[model samples]
Each structure stands twice: as C-alpha cells, then as structure tokens.
Target: MTGTDEGRLHTAVLVGPEGEHRRHRKARQKAATRIESTARDARKAQAKARRDAEQAERRNTTYLPSAGESGPAALRTPGRLRLPKHQDTSATLAGQYPFLAEGGLGSSGVFVGQDLYSGGSFVYDPWVLYQQGLITAPNVVLAGIVGSGKSSLAKSLYTRSLPFGRRVYVPGDPKGEHTAVAEAVGGKAIVLGHGLSNRLNPLDEGHRPSTVSDVEWAMQVASRRRDLIGALAETVLDRALSPLEHTAIDLALRDAVRSAEVPILPMVVDRILAPNPADDEDGRLAEDGRLVGHALRRLVAGDLQGLFDGPSTVRFDPSLPMVSLDLSRVAENSTLLSVLMTCSSAWMESALSDPNGGQRWVIYDEAWRLMAYPALLRRMDAQWRMSRHFGIANMLIFHKLSDLDNVGDQGSAMRALASSLLANAETRIVYRQEADQLGSTAAALGLTGTEQKLLPGLGTGQGLWRIKDRSFVVQHQLHPAELAAFDTTTRMTEIARKISDLDVPSGISNDQEES
Candidate 1:
C-alpha cells in the first residue's frame, strides 16, 4: 500500500506543476496582449494630441486678420497702426535718436571751443587728426582782416598746445606782437634792431639736433652754411646765384670756417671780396664772386648793418615753450628783417628735425613780410613741405588771401610756391573778410556758396575752419585770462580807457566821452 501511494504522489506532483505552468503561461500571454493594446491606444492618443496641437498652431498662425476683419484676436489696428507724426528738439530726441549727433573728434585732443553746427565741444589736434585719418597735412593757413582776432586765435592755438608738450617757433613776429607771448609762455624773445646789440651771425652752427651724429651734424652745418650764404647773397642780389658764384661763396665759407672757431658774415664777405691767392690765381674767382661778395657785404657795411654783422648775442633755446624773433624794432628796415629771419630759421632747423623735439608749432606771424623775400619764401615752403615728416605744425597767418598776390608777379614761381603753401596746409581758418575779399577768398579756399556767405558775417573770436574737406564755423571762446593776455587792441583800449576816464559832464555818459 505505501509503494502505490508513493507512485501516485510523484505523479500527482509532476502533473500538478505542469498544469500550474500552463495556467501561468495563459495569464502572461493575456497580460502581454492587454499591455500591447494599451500601448497601441496610448500611441494613437499621442498622435491625435500631436495632430491637435499642430492644427491649433496652424490656426493660431494664420494670416493676421485684415483691418476690417473682426475676431477674438490681438486687435492689431490695420494699415500699420499709424500714429500722429511727432516732432521734438534734437536735444530731447537724442536719447531716442542714437548716433544722430557726431560722436565728436574723440575727446583725446585739446578743447577748441564749440562747433557751431554740431552744437558740441569742438576739439582739434593735428596729430590726432592725422592719426584718425582726417588730415594728411598739419600745416595751417590763417587769414583774417585787421582787428578780427586772428592774431589772438593764432596765439591761443600755440599757447594752448604748449601744455600738450608742443614748442612754438614764431620765426618772424614782424610787429613784435609775439614778444610778450613768448616771454609769458616761459620762452625767450630775441629782439634785434639797429641799436639793440643783438647781432645774429648767420654762420653760427645753430642748434644741433640731439639725435644727429657728429658726422651728420658736420655735413648739415656745412650744407646749412653754404645754403645760408647763398641765400643771403640771393636775397641781397634779388636773384639766384650762378654756379661760379656758388663755388666762390663755398670757397669763402670754407676759408672763413678754417680761420675762426665760429665764422662771421664779415669774414665770409671779406674772403669773397678779397679772394685768396691760391683760389683766385687767375682773378676769375674774385670776378665770379664779385657780385655775390658785394651783395653779402650789405649785411656787414651796406644798409643792412648791425644785425648780422657779428655773432649771435642770444642763443635759441629750442627746449623752451616758445622762441620768437621779435623784429618790431627793425620792422621799418625790410632787409634787416629778412636777414634776421633767415638766421633764425637756420637756428631752428636742427630743433625742428630733432626726433626728441616731440611736436612744435612754427608760427609765421605777419607772413606778408616774410613772403616779400624770395629766400624767406623758399625757406617757408621747405618747412611747410616737410611739416609732417618733422612732426611740426606750421601756421602761416595773413591779413587776407589776396595778400598772396603781393608776394610775386602774376603767374610767377613765387606766386605758385605761395599758393602751394595754401595747398599743403589742409587747415584754413578764415576769420572775417571784407565784402570785396569774398570772391578771391572763396575761390582760393574752394569754399561753398554757404561757406562764402559766412566769411563776412563772422564776428570777433569766430572763425570758419576748413579742415581737410570738413567745414566748421567755430566761435573761439577764450577765458578772461586768455582775452586779457591776447588783447591786440590794447593801444586803442588804453586810449579809450583814458578817454573814458576824462571827467564827464553831468549829462554825458562814458560812451559820449569816448566819442
């Protein structure tokens, strides 16, 4: 009985487990089918939801309803939502209107009053303008009528530039207006005249640039002396020297140099007139140099005496803020003035070429006097041409553009050179001109009709600045100190003050008293 029970139990266990396995398999298969169906439904629902979203988006993104069309939509007033046109002052609109105003000549340079057009501070600096590609030339030509404040403007330009490490070289202040300015700016003014004992030996080896080597300096001095002597002879003779004359002058200069540590014009004149035996063996040397010697002798014994007859009494200190040759004492004598300018120009040449000299303002005040002499004009032309290379800004001041006509004959090379000065100077400042000067000034400056009209109307301390192709009507504002320092009408003002000081009657006013 136990054996049969054991067999049945074993069979029952195997069959029972197999039946359970089959039931589990059926349940798992049904669960998997349900899961598959549920997943299929979920996928269908997702696709429907995605399609609904797409339809909603497309509906929402349809063409904006037309102006007339009404709907529960963003009420965009059709036809661009026009508003009443509005206007406001530029000062007020500056916030709304960006970039309408000039960003200004970047605030890096000197403050030169305000721009009448832009209604903002106008700044000017030749170096800054050059760096910014606004100007390729730094030389300036300033023209204005008498009592128009052009002189004040010129003085201000250079004096203001001094703080920026610039030096001023007023080669020839014929009226001596710059003497006070020179002394005021911590500079020296060399006043040479008939009795002042300020002898300016033209042969003096003037300032030698610190950067030049001994050899280069020697060559420069030799070349300068040779050129100077020739220029002097030409100035006196009123013509360029011949090659033979040049040779004779060169030989005389060499002899003078060998004879003294510092040669004088008298020595050169002596050597030229009374030739050396070796050089003038055939007497042709003396004949060739005869005219040049007599011409140069004018500096020593001729009417042009006392100035260049001896060594320089004063040294040209280029390191100073200003160096002005005050020629007022000798203003009546044109030859003496020309000789002094020539010597001073030679004295300044080395400093001008000095790399360490930084920036300089070479002001040629009363340029009319300078242009009268061909030698001086050529020298000025050379300085103007090389202004950029030497890092100097030359300012040639004139009473009017027509003053150039007084330089040389019509269509002459001197006139052309004078005109070239205006051409080379990219900056032209026209203060105030008479009505008659309008056409010539306008044509010479290439001023527009609008600009031409502005010349005559310019007031005191106002200038029409034509810088490179850009035009600006600037009202040069000076501080009280500047006005006091640059007052050119002091003589008239003093007379007025004296007239005003006169005891006025009970009913009379200061104006009446002045009148």
Candidate 2:
C-alpha cells in the first residue's frame, strides 16, 4: 500500500520540484540583467563626462580677438585697430608727470605708511625729522605751553647726554626739576644765601663756597637791585679802567686770589676807589696802576680764598655725568646770579681747553629767565663760538616762545641769534606745542607741510627730530622711575633734603630748613 501511494506522491513531488527550479533560474536571469544594466549606465556616464571635459579644454585653449582673428597679429585688422582717443596724450602726461607711489620706505631711514614725494622727489621719514641734529644745542628756542612736555623733551635730551659723557649743569629753584637731574647724574647742586654759608658746611663731603668772582657774578645776576650789580661790575672793572686796554680780568682776578689774604670783593672795591697817586691828568695810570690795584685787591681781600676755600657753593666732579645748580632759593637774589654762574662755568671749561674728543653737554632748565641777563646771552653766544672747537653742547629749555621776548628792541635780533644757535645743532627734537605757536615756530624752523600738520597732534613723549638730511617723528619712552622723579613736588623735596644734608652752621641750617 505504501509503495503505490508513495509512487503517486513522488511523481507529484518531482513535478513540483522541477517547477520550483525553473522559477529560481528565471529569477537568477532577471537579477543578472539588472546588474548588467547598472554597469552599462555607469560606463555611459563616465564616457559622457570625459567628452564634456575635453570639449571645455578645447574651448579654453582657443583665444580669438573680437574681430574673430587669433593672437596679437589680428590687431592689424581694421576693426581691431581703433586706438583710444587720449592714448598719446596720456602717455605724454605720464612721461612728464610721474605718479608717486605710496606706502614705501622713506629717506629718513624709517618705513611709514606712505612715502612723501613732490614731483617724484621723496620728502622724509617723519621719525628721522625729529631726530636730526638741528635743535640739539643751546639757543634753540623751545616754545610750548605747560603740560606740552617741552620740559620732558629737554630732560630726555639731558638723560641721553649722560651716555655720551656730556656734562650737564642746571640751576636749582624751588621747583628743582633740573636739580633732580643733577642728583641723578651725581653732580653738584649749589644753594647760596646769607645763612646758607653757615648751614652748608664747606668742609662737608662735597660742599664748598662759590669763588669770590663766582659770588660777585652771582650777586650781579641774582641781585634784584640792578644798581647793586652795576656797582659790583663797575667796582670790579674800575681797577683796570682803560677802555682800549682790555685785560684778562678773570685770569688776573684768579691770580690775585691765589696770592691774597682778605676777601676779594672788598679788596677789589677798595682798590678801584683808592686814588692812584701815580696817575696824572689822563685817566690812564703811568705804571699800570689798574693792574697793581686789581692784584692788590685780589691779594688783600679774601676773594680768591672765598671761591677756592672750604664750603664751595658748587661742588663738581668731571667724572660725574651732570651738574645742576639749584637757584630756586636764589629768587631773592637777582636772576643774574644764574647767568653769571652759567657763563663763568662755560668760560672756565673753555679755558681748560681739553680736546680729547669727549663731548660736554650744558643744559639750562627753565632757560626762560636766562634771557633777561645780557651776560647770559653773551655766554650763549660764547658757547656757540666755542662749540665747534670744544665739542661743548648747550641745551636751553623754556616754557614758551615768549620767554625769549625779553631781549627788548633786540627781540628780532635775539630771535635771529637764537635761530643761528639752533641751526648749529645737529638734532632738533620738537614735542607737543600749542597749535598756533607750533605752527609759527615750525615754519620758522623750515619744517615741511607734513611735519607742520602732524606736530600739534603728537602724543606725550612723541616728537619730531630733524638731522642733516633726514627727519622723523617718534614716540620717546622713559623709565617709570625717571618720570616719577621729575614730578615738581618730588624734585623740590629732593633738593631740600640735599640742602639739609650740607650741615652748615645753625643759622644756615635754619635758613635752609625754612627753604
């Protein structure tokens, strides 16, 4: 039974299996066709992309003029040959009037945003203009209002002078701005007055009284009483009275002091007033009585001894970089004292006549007052006269242009004189100034248009420096301590302390303490 049933089922099963196998083969064929279609599509796409790229390359490689010809040779064609109307004119103009390129290196040895040029000629680097050696020495007028930092520029120059081994001298006033510089540079500060003699121990470490000549000169300059100064000069000069017979009076006086016993001023005065028994009708004495009287007065009076003796008013060391003379206390005295001391120092330095290529810098802080003294003007002139020979440089600092106006009818003359002094300087540094004042002074100094425009806008410690052929505007930087030390109150306190340390007599101590 099972064989018969199995035979029938087997036959049916074989038929079903054959049917399933045929269906499976059809499905495999359909899948193979779809795979071939996908590959064909991909190959077609790749061929199309390559053809498009080649076509684009061909198009790019081909260049044609608008007239439809190829290359520069096609320019000769009529349509392509049209020239611009102003081509020749533009070419000619270009040849004659060249364009100035901006943003390039300037002649001043600095790179600025733009190179200044006039008709193809370069102006200068703004920084180099300020650094040029034009306004470095004495007589160069610094005109600016308070807070303009004109004084700071002066101080910066003084500081720079130290590295060069330059000697700087400043007068001490209560403000003592310059006096601080002297102390910083290890120089002397001289404070003189009635009780100052006692309070300032001439025997102290670095203390000494000023020379008799120095004292007289100080009296002449600092004496508010012009009559007193006039009398002093007359008395001092009278012993050698011949108008044409000029003597080396300073030298002669110095010599007399070396040999004398009494105070020099009194002896000089007495000799001048003494009637010359040998003189005849003519004012001239037969045997040079003026010389003898001068000698005798210098010898008898303590003039030379007073100057060279203990308690020197001015203590100086050539090795020290700078010397500051405090004259703030000398306000009771004439402004003339400052002038005399300054002039005398310059004269003495010149007299020493050492020329070993070392440079000496003498700075006058608050130089405005110096203009009042003719002797100072003369000394300034003398500095100019001797600068080239001695390498001595003078820097005169002032608050405003008006400070130089005290020269009276010779105002213009004085201006010219000052200008000459400025011209001799190798560098001119100008900081912020009042617009009107800066404009005028810049014009006078021959600053260019760019410099004139930029000067008033300069920031603190920023300035214009001019040397021989170059000019530049630069921002000067200083140490924080230096800035703090220069403050007015700080400076005054320092000078007061220095004076107190002098250890003069009680009276002098009291006077200094009061100061």
Error of 2 at 105 (Å): 14
Best by TM-score: 1
Candidate 1 lDDT, 346-443, residue by residue in tens = 88888888888889999998888889889899999999999988999999999999999887999999999999999999999999999999999999
Write one digit per residue (lDDT tens) for candidate 2, span 478-497.
Answer: 56776776555555689899
Q: Which runs of model 2 end up more than 4 angstroms from their true locations?
A: 1-143, 160-164, 171-174, 198-263, 279-315, 336-352, 410-416, 489-515
Reference-based lDDT, each prediction: 0.88, 0.50
Cα error, residue 343 of model 1, in Å, equals 1.1
Per-prediction TM-score to the true structure, in the order listed: 0.79, 0.54
Q: In model 2, how large is the Cα lDDT of residue 156?
A: 64
Name the lDDT of candidate 1: 0.88
- Model 1: residue 102 alpha-carbon error in angstroms: 4.9
